[model samples]
Target: MKGPLFYAKILLFGEYGIIKDSKGLAIPYNSYQGALKMSENPSDVAKKSNQNLLKYYKYLSDLKTDLVHFRLDELKRDIDGGMYFDSSIPQGYGVGSSGALVASIYDKYADDKITVLENLTRDKLLNLKHIFSLMESFFHGKSSGLDPLNSYLSLPILINSKDHVEPTGIPSQKQGKGAVFLLDSEITGETEPMVNIFMNKMKNEGFRRMLNEDFAKYTDACIDDFLHGNVKSLFGNVKNLSKVVLSNFKPMIPMAFHQIWQQGIETNAYYLKLCGSGGGGYILGFTEDYEKAKDLLKNYKLELVYRF
Candidate 1:
């Protein structure tokens, strides 16, 4: 038995800022995806996945929540019958790997799950986020739930604040020189530890002030500028955001890419921001000229996302 596919997601803006009720924007990234499938003869990878699913089933069964209930019996039956998630989404890459898994499980087993076709009011979106948060806590120590929410809906989501979130439309991609891209850090990141560092940093009064004033302000502006298709303004805000991240969020960034992150800001070739929690994963990049940015960073691997 095979279930439907679930895609990965990119949190373009507001990574850590969102934890503090700052606005965030997340979009579906179809390049990497996963789906639930079953096989009579499972491969080694499938066996591992199935084993993981068994643990996840137990976790779900033990969860106490009114937000959503899983059909644990059927889920276990499927796992017992050699069902596993067949996926291309890389774990620990800042892309929504576990989010896709949570989304797939909910898609197949949740009772009275909110269908994507239904009217997704603010309350409904919040409820889904809440439900996903509970389910995904099995992976991340704590979660905002935006990753699974984006994967489940397969649409752009805008978080106005902690309590307000809704489906959003982004400016259509254009074949132009300006672009949004990902730079492979070539190092895997663990979300839990990175998040722990941020949590610890929050105890510093200076860090908290910077987060509330500069980080949130720039993140909110970048979201607005990108959505409005204000390319010039977007770059300006992205530069500031990148600078702030480099200065304050140093621990989250991998040591190898520190110089490049600064080079982009100085040269105006591109602006780099944390793709996810960012101990190492993919670093999000914004450039006015893709070709030139590509030329400037020729040694590093780059993947184009959206074109301006």
Candidate 2:
């Protein structure tokens, strides 16, 4: 049996800024997706996936919460029946690979799951986020639940604050020259370490001030400008945000890309920011001209996401 598909997610803005109550935006990326299915002939890869699912099943079975319930017996049976998650979403790339898997499991096994077609009031949204956060925490020691929420809902989400989130409408992709793209870092990122660095930095008064005043300010501005389709203003804020990330989030940026990150700010070719924790994974890029950005960033693999 094959369950429904769940898509990957891209956090266009927010990243670390969201933890400090900065506004954030996330959108569904349909190019990569995942689903739960049973295989007649389990290959080594499929067997590994099944083994992992068995571990996840134990985690979910032991999960204690009234927020959601799962048909653990059925999930267990599926795991024993050579079931595996068949997905194309790359893990450790900050594209919500585990989020999609979490979404798929919830869709297929949850007894009273919140269906995506519902009206989704603010409270309902919060409940879903909380449940996803708990479920995804198995993958990451801690989670905000935004990734799984986006994958499950398959809608753009706007975070007004730490406690406030709502379904949002973003400007449709236009056939324009400006675009949002992803540059593969060719290295996996470890979220917990990067987050620990941020938390440790929070102890410094100067870093706290910059995060509150500079990072949050630009992040909020970028989200507002993006939702309002203010391309000119959005890029301006993205440039500033890029600068702030470079100056402050030095450890998150790979050592090799430090100069490249700075060059974007100076050249106006494109602005790059952390896609997620940013130790290494995908670096999000924004360009007023895709062709120009592509040529300038020719050595790396870039995936165009949205157009301005």
Q: What is the Cα-based lDDT of residue 235 in candidate 2?
A: 96
| TM-score result, candidate 2 | 0.98
Count the clashes in each prediction: 0, 0
Question: 97-178, model 2: which lDDT tens digit per residue?
Answer: 9999999998888887888787888999999999999999998788999999999999999999878999999888899999
- Candidate 1 TM-score versus the reference: 0.99
Output the number of the TM-score-best candidate. Answer: 1
Summarize candidate 1's per-residue lDDT along 193-249 as a digit string, tens digits: 999999999999999999999999999999999999999999999999999999999
Best by lDDT: 1
Model 2, stretches more than 4 Å misplaced?
Answer: none
Q: Report the Cα lDDT for candidate 2.
A: 0.93
